[model samples]
Target: MEERSNYVLRDNNDIGTVQIADDVVAMIASLAVRDIEGVEACAGNMAGELMDKVGIKNARKGAKIDIFENRVKVDVFVNIAYGYNIPVTCGKVQDKVKTTIENMTGLTVTDVNVRVVAVSMPNNK
Candidate 1:
């Protein structure tokens, strides 16, 4: 299997160029959303889901990262836990992801787009 070798380059004149993997930002976003109360899980697309089914776990599964001109745009896919306000929860997600990524990477986060893929209901006992 081949690996994706994508990186976000940050050049530091006094030191050296810093390379941040695209997957690293995605993983950061994934962890950021975990603390939200209404978040069920980071839900990836059909292909990612299929890969998960086969035990090919992806650290950056549900988050898509785009970098250009030293700025970033991220799309996060998630399943909301049942009985939470969608708007509020998504807003929280957006804020958390944007802030977390910017703080960690020192890059300007242009946008954090949240897509609610599903509403997870609890299984009856």
Candidate 2:
């Protein structure tokens, strides 16, 4: 047996091994959220927000992904557009992220936790 760290091994055959990184999983979640209608933006965690202040931007800003024995858990912070139903938007985000990750990575997504950090005001100009 071999010891694995960040990446999860999806398959191993005579040719080679296929692995998916945690960062990659986070990126997938972020993208899935982006496509949802009412998502204003993906808000980063405290550390990631601090990094932004200093001119460093995290590519995968809002999504936090954890993998354990081929199972994945995701936490995504988001800003929703004003007047949109919060529960509906969050539910859409949850469903999309879970389906996308499972389809793409072949790993089971145990749960997707959505945190509504802020709501963007609709512009009337």
Q: Model-by-model lDDT, in order?
A: 0.81, 0.80
Pairs with steric clashes in candidate 1:
none
lDDT of 1 by residue, 67-109 (tens): 7776898988888989999999999999999999989988889
The window of 10 residues in a row where model 2 has the poorest summed lDDT is 1-10
TM-score result, candidate 1: 0.80
Q: Candidate 2 — which pairs collide?
A: none
Which lDDT tens digits does candidate 2 get at residues 81-101?
A: 998999999999999999999
lDDT of 1 at 76: 87
Provide the clash count, candidate 2.
0
